[model samples]
Structure formats: C-alpha cells, structure tokens
Target: MSRIEWERIGRERRRVSRWSGGTTAEIAIHPATSQYAARNFAWRVSTATVEAERTDFTPLDGFSRILMVLENELTLHHEGHGTYRLRPYEQNAFEGGWRTSSEGRATDFNLIYDSRLRARMSVLEVPGEAALVAAVGSLPCEEGEHWIHRIWYTAEGSVEAADAGGNALCRLDAGDALLFAVHRSHGEESWSLRNAASGRAVVIESVVFS
Candidate 1:
C-alpha cells in the first residue's frame, strides 16, 4: 500500500441528500470541494434510491454515466437509445445527456465521470465463507495515462478486508466503502477480502484513470 492513499467512509461520513425522486448518498468524488450539483466534478460515485414510480433523470450534457440497480427491477427509457430493463447488479452505461427516465422503484449504484476521462464500473459477488483477491493498476493503459484509483463499495452484507501482507484493513458493511488512490508508475497492487456474514456479499468496484 505504499504510495497509495486510502479512505474508509462509514455511515456517519456519508453525505445523504433527498431529491424529488428519492435520496442519494455521495460516496466519493474527485477533488474534495468539487460539487456534483454544479457538475464541476471530474468523477463521482454514489448510491441512490428511486422512490417515485416514474422519475426523470437530470440531463448531464458533458458526462458519461454508469448506473447499476442494487435492488428490484428498473426499466430505463433513454431517448434516442433503446430502453434497458435491468435487474439487481445489472448496469447500463450511457451518455449523460440522454433524455432518460425510469419506471419502477429501485436502489442503484452509480458512477458518473467527465467524458474526457476513462472509467469502468462492475459488480463483484463473493460467496459465503469465501475469500476474493482484487487488484488495482491491472487495467490496460497507455504510457502517459494510467489507472489512479480503485473504489470498492459494499452493497450487501459485510466483508473483512486485508492488504497483500495480511494486515487488517477494515470491515465494510452495507453502504460502506474503501477507496485507494495512487500515482506514478506502478505494476499492480492487490487486496484480499472475505465475506463475514451469511449469504452472498455484493461489492461494487469502480476504477478510474486521470
């Protein structure tokens, strides 16, 4: 974990906001003071619950968004783009400027980034009593541009994390997250995590390059 900076965001640290549609909690954002509402962020990761039966999405003209349903079914109607019916953990990537609306209620995870930067989002499921090894800096990149951050959000259950040397990191419960950031030339770094509760654990992993 040398040369890397990490943060643990527990429940108390979350900035939860209520919108017309539902509530959204900001997990992490690039540049400490950047505003999501003002659309001044380079990237942002958040989880939101859509409570209204039908809700319109805010049009973000210069961004790209990746949204994943964490619970229930969600039907997204993206104007000019085909409608997408997504189940739990299923994600849809589209331009932020699309005229998008949703039908049905759901709790979702999102990664919205400036279109000029490269980003990737995915869901990882860890079975009960199982351990998973995850790595950052493994994504393919060019010489000048490289992966700089890796974020893991625990969406379900709890997970105990440890570094490559087996040093304890922290336990991430539902809505908790671990973010690691690094710079310069690095080959790869890994983290080991184990599910500490019954049933499967769902983790949303988002990787970004500056």
Candidate 2:
C-alpha cells in the first residue's frame, strides 16, 4: 500500500525551551517521544534562537545535524572544522558529536537524525509563481526497495503540495510542513508544490532514511 501524511503544526503546539544560550522551539519529531531526550528520538526538527553570548551545543554522540539560519545571521564554530557563518537560508551539515559553539543572535532551523539513518536537507527559495511551480515539479521521485521519506517545511510564505493529476494534498503556510513516505511499492508516484500567494517563499526539504 502507498500512503502519505500531512501534519500542520501551529505555533502554539510547538514546545519552547529556554537554554543558556537562548531558546529552542521544537517543530516536530519522529517516533513521537513524550520527552526531549536525545536517545528517545530517531529524528528531530526545531528552531533555535541563539543569544549574543556564546553557548555550547549539547553533544549527540551518534547523530548528524543540519542547521539553517531563518532569521538574521550567526556563526557556528566547530572545534576542528573552523567557523561557519550562515546567513538567512544558508545550510550546513556536521556531526552532532563535534564540539560546537555559537555566537551572535539568530533564529535557525535544525534537522537532526540518528547516524544509523541517512538524511539530507536543502533550502529552496521560490521568487515567483513560475519559479514556485518549477521548484515543485523538480522534487525527486525515486524507485527503491528501502523506505524513503520526504519532509517539506515552509520557512516563509505559503505553498501547496499536489499530485500529478492536480489533486491537492496539503497547504503549508509559514512554519507548516508536509511529510511524504514511500516504501516498497508498485507503480510510480509524483508529488509537487506550488506557491499559494504572490511573493517569495522559502522551503526546507529533508530526505530521510533513503
């Protein structure tokens, strides 16, 4: 059987935490654990706002992390890799075990997954209607034996995901998301997203466990 799921997380449903550096607001997580323990989660997505003061990130011994700046700019200093200055929508990937620290204030999105799972994240910016359609049409649809999941998150503006036949799957506004899953299945399936309003829209695409 083929299946797809859509989940809209309002700002209120998100969990906010105050850290020494600043604050972290969770967007969504896999396995749906009740607590925020790293070992209980296979994957996690959240937004962290760093304060001006330098702060060290918690070490996740066996995980990989993708970080993207959504508001303002920040620099991440990795113990061995040097410093990474990220502007709005810029993304960087690093091993969670790396001793990392951040300076400057900025709101950033994060995607963390256990090292056992393969995952990749990219930021997409659609400037106009035509560009939005093209971006949606370019989503990858691969056939494979292993299960593959794709998560589309609207960082700014609004968009809608649909099938090849123009059937609406879901609408995503700023901070909203759509998650699509595919396992061993027959036949081909294609999914795409289009801008819902006139203006630029930013989306974060995450391909997991592929």
Candidate 3:
C-alpha cells in the first residue's frame, strides 16, 4: 500500500470470475492476494446477473453484500418476505442464503464484505464542477497515523487526479473506478479537474478498522 497508484478497468483485463449456482460476472480484487480467500473479510467488486424463474442461493456465512444496479431492472423476492425492485444506478441490499429468490433479469455491482470483521462502508455521489484550472503543485502530502483510502468513479465526465510528483494516476470515463491508498504519513493532498460533465460524479469510500 503506497501513497498513490493509477487504476483502470477495461475489457480483457480478467477482472471477473464465475460464482456457484450458475452465475456469471467480473471481479476486481483489491490488494490482489491469494490469502484473501481465507481471510476474515476482503473487499470484492463484482457484476452478476439474475435470470427468470431463478431462486435460492446459500447464505454466505458471516458475510453481507451490497448491490448496485449497473444494467437492466429486476424484482427480488424472498421467502416469507416482500418484493423489491432495483433499476440502473439504484442500490439495494440482500442477505445471501437459500431464502433469496429472483425473477426477471439484471446486472449489478456487488460489494461483499465479511460480517465478522465489522468493517463499515458507504457510497457518496460526488458533484461535478464546470471547470478547474489544474496547477503543477496540486496534490500535497499529509501527516498522520490513520489509514486513508479514496476511490473515484466516472459517473459524468472525465477526471484526472494526481499527487504533487506529477504522476498521472487516473484517467477515467463513465463506469470506471479508481482506487487510492496511503500507507504512510502524508501531507496535504489535492484533486484536479478538467472538462466536467453536467451530472454529479459518484465516489465510494470504505473504512476498515482492524
């Protein structure tokens, strides 16, 4: 985990892996390690689908998942529970177990974190600026002992964020995500903006206390 690293998501990147019960999707593993499979909890980004008349999935022991619809609309049904609908860009949460059922189809982003770890998470919709005059000495360093992780997703227009060293860390379009981690003490850090889109940009930040 270093101060700043650029990330990009593209086709043929092999970011996806298939799951049990006949589900297909892509996955991006942060910290990209083989030990993660047996760890208490790990953050995984995935895109999954739900076909018509499909029902039941084993409850992930000590794990919870957050769903963000990326494509299509879907209606979810649970045994002894009610039905809920999610559209593109909308979000919802569901327990993974045999009780969950699905009808129709959808493609969604999943945030799977082990419940035993008690890690907290949240998603924020960042507002876009019309324009920004980026300078050479923008991103400064910070000094502290706390851990800070920042990620920006392209929801509207293009964005470029870098450190004071003039390294191009992120250049993203709509539906792209960038991850940043600061491992040591740092100073002031700044973000630069170029051509902006009308709609607001969205960012998802997760803090884990171990």
Candidate 4:
C-alpha cells in the first residue's frame, strides 16, 4: 500500500543560519552528500529575510535555482538578462552559473537543485475551497521509472492537507513545510488542502524529478 509520511516543521527547527550579503539565511532543508568537494546534492531549500535595499546572491555553480518573493517586492538583475521585478508570490528561475543580484527588501523562499535533476517551484494561494483543491490536485505522483518528491511550505496562514478519506496528513503554519516522496509503485493518490487559519493561506510548492 502507498503511504504518505508526514512531518511538521516548527520555528525551532529553523534555527540554523548562514550569513551572506549582510543578512542571515535559514536553511530549511539540505540533503546530505558524501564529500565536501561534491558539487551536486539531491536538493536544498531555504529562506531569507532581506532587510537591506540591495543584496547579492551567493554564486552557486552546477545547480539550478528558483527564488520566490514571500513578502514585499524586489528586482533581480541577472548578469546577462537585465532586471526582472518580482512581487509577492512571484518567482524566477535561473541557471546557477548566472551572476544574480537583487535590490529591495523582502522575505524570500529559495530552492536549489543539482543540474542533473529536474525541478520546479510555484506559489499557490488558497483563498477558497476551489483554489485549495486545485492546488492539491496539481501535485504530481511518480510514474514509470521516474520519481517525484515534493516540499510544501506555508508562506501565509496555516494550512492542512488530508488524504482522500479525510485522514489528516499534515498541518503547516507560516514558515513550516512538509516533504514527501512518491514512487511509481504507489499507484494513484489524492489529497486535499484547506486554509486552517482564519484567512487565506499561501503555499510554496517545490518539486524535484529524479
């Protein structure tokens, strides 16, 4: 039988920080690698609150990166691609080799994956029942030889996900996340999500294809 392993990340787990660009970043998830020289990792997710008007992103080689604005607005300047403005919930993807810089203060969510793996990230707002269902329905399951892994982060209010028969799977608060794996052998699966708090909830979904 296919099963969903659930986990809840609270504020205490986000205690680790890495300093860069005059700010500290919270490392939410970092997959283990065998050696220090190993450039590739399974995946990594993190968040940072940029208090300064301008911040330089650390150069990451041999990886693909996605950044989403969790609050406020910011403009990203890619070495070759001109400046791109991002508002709340908006995201941009770039090759890790690019020299990227940003200006304006905002809380941001980031996903970085090895170049060999395929990855995608998106932000969904669950303001009503239909929107919540649509977001949950968009999660893809493993098929054939491919495997899919997903990470869900709550950016706004609290949210809860449940299995088809109404079994509570996971509940996430602002800054919390749930990561799970799906395999081809799991067969078809269905899940639903609802805004557990009083208002709308925003979710950031990061998926990896390996």
Question: Which candidate's lDDT is highest?
Answer: 1
lDDT per residue for candidate 4 within 39-116, as digits (tens), equals 546678878788778777777788888888888998999988778999988889898788888899888888888777
Segments in model 3 whose C-alpha atoms lie over 4 Å from true places: 1-6, 9-11, 19-23, 35-41, 80-82, 118-158, 163-167, 183-210
Model 2 lDDT tens row, 21-74: 888988878867645674778788888888856789999888899999989988
After superposition, which runs of candidate 4 have C-alpha atoms over 4 Å from their true positions? Answer: 22-40, 128-131, 134-145
lDDT of each: 0.87, 0.76, 0.53, 0.73
Residue 200 displacement in candidate 3 (angstroms): 8.3
Worst 10 residues of 1 by lDDT: 138-147
Model 3 lDDT vs. the true structure? 0.53
Runs in model 1 lying further than 4 Å from the true structure: none
Best by TM-score: 1
Tens-digit lDDT track for model 1 on 83-165? 99999989999999999999999999999999988888888888786689887556666566655777899998899888777
Worst lDDT window (10 residues) for model 2? 131-140
Using lDDT as the yardstick, the better of models 3 and 4 is 4
Per-residue lDDT tens digits for candidate 3, residues 148-200, read 34444444445655455555555656556665554434555454544445666
Task: Point out the worst 10-residue segment of candidate 4 by lDDT.
Answer: 28-37
Rate residue 91 of model 2 by lDDT: 85
Candidate 1 TM-score to native = 0.94
